[model samples]
Target: MSQSIIAKRYADALFQLGKERSKLDQFETELLTLREVYRDNNKIVSFLKHPRVSVDQKKKVMTDSFQSFSEEIVNTLKLLVERHREDIIADMIQHYIGMMNDAKGIADADVYSVRELSEAEKQRLSETFAPKVGKQSLNLTNIVDSSILGGIRLRVGNRIFDGSVSGKLRRIERELVSTNKR
Candidate 1:
């Protein structure tokens, strides 16, 4: 099977387990932390993938590194190590988080603006855009992008809602160019 398919299967199983244990939120948090660690430390993944390293040592390292995490997550990591599937760890975590977010009616969004958005502004944006995307709310991540010049540009999944001044200008320019060509 493909890597993404395998990862999704593992994620689905974990999601079911989390639901059964009433720990979806906790598992999501732990998975996010694990993803961060994997992203910031390439050595850990390399160490786990190294041919010279034994499976026992890799499992021990994972357990020791995440001793405080829930048993489900730790065991999952150990299982991945044993199966020589360390490369799919990040993808599995991402899939798990996506599943959790879907279950919670939440969508992750990136809002680009000239400056950092205030909490109230973020909340307002979430309130306004969430319903449009068929979500209860948005987990907004504000990205300060001066290139947008003014207003905000919202991105959710594959859609981009461009309300920025730069975007408007671009649209106008495209229209003018097309008209002139005609």
Candidate 2:
């Protein structure tokens, strides 16, 4: 099976277990932390993937590193190590988080602006855009992007609502070119 398919299956199983234990929120939090650690530390993954490392050593390392994490997450990491599927850890965590977010009616969004958005602006954007995306609310991450020039560009999932000045200019340019072609 494909890596994504395997990851999704693991995520689904973890999600079901989380629901059964009434620990979905906690598991989500732990998964997020694991994602962050994996992102920031390449050495950890490298160490786990090293051919010289024994499965027992890898499992011990994972358990020791994440002793504070819940048993479910720790066991999952150990299982991944044992199976030599460390590469899918990040994808699995992401899928699990996505499942949790869907259950909570929340969507993660990136709002790109020329400057850092104020809390009020973020709240207003969340309010205006959440319903349009069929989500109760958005967990907005503001990205200061000078390339947008002005206005804001909001991205939720694969959809991008581009209201930036540069985006508008590009749209107009496209229209003009298409009109000229005709």
Candidate 3:
């Protein structure tokens, strides 16, 4: 009933279907693309989740939206709509991708920097972070965020190491206040 459970169920079903049909990679890609579409476009999401709209209408929109995508993904979206499982759309796709990566023995990495990191810097960071991950191989993604002020925030799976200037400032402020109180 919960979104998490629905996502897990849909992800498992999709993973099994993908594995059996030997199209897991394609399916994963399509799913990820569709998930991004949903994330970036608020209108499409509102249409699907709108209580007034019929499932058939939503399915049509989904099919039209993903016209260029693979039949597997389009059909899967249709099935999800038909089953009233739209809530799990994003989570299922993400979870399915994770499963596919695991199957290929690859790990996902995310590095957030205050500014665009140079290729050499990225490579060095990857080299430093990748080896620490228990995953066989790592796929590192760089994200630039000016709000960090300075430094990098490396996230490998669920673990996050915050090395940003904001984080440092907060730690320093905390220590300062604590010392002042003492």
The order of the candidates by lDDT, greatest first, is 1, 2, 3
Clashes of 2: 0
Write one digit per residue (lDDT tens) for candidate 3, span 73-95.
Answer: 88888998888878788888888
Candidate 1 pairs with clashing backbones: none
How many backbone collisions does model 3 have?
0
Error of 1 at 61 (Å): 2.0
lDDT of 2 at 177: 100
| lDDT values for all models | 0.95, 0.95, 0.84
Q: Whose lDDT is greatest here?
A: 1
To one decimal, what is the Cα RMSD in angstroms of model 3 from the true structure?
3.7
lDDT of 2 by residue, 45-110 (tens): 899889999999999999999999999999999998889899999999989988988998999999
Once fitted onto the true fold, the runs of candidate 2 whose alpha carbons sit more than 4 angstroms away are 174-182
Candidate 3 runs further than 4 Å off: 112-115, 141-153, 160-182
The 10-residue segment of model 3 with minimum total lDDT is 129-138
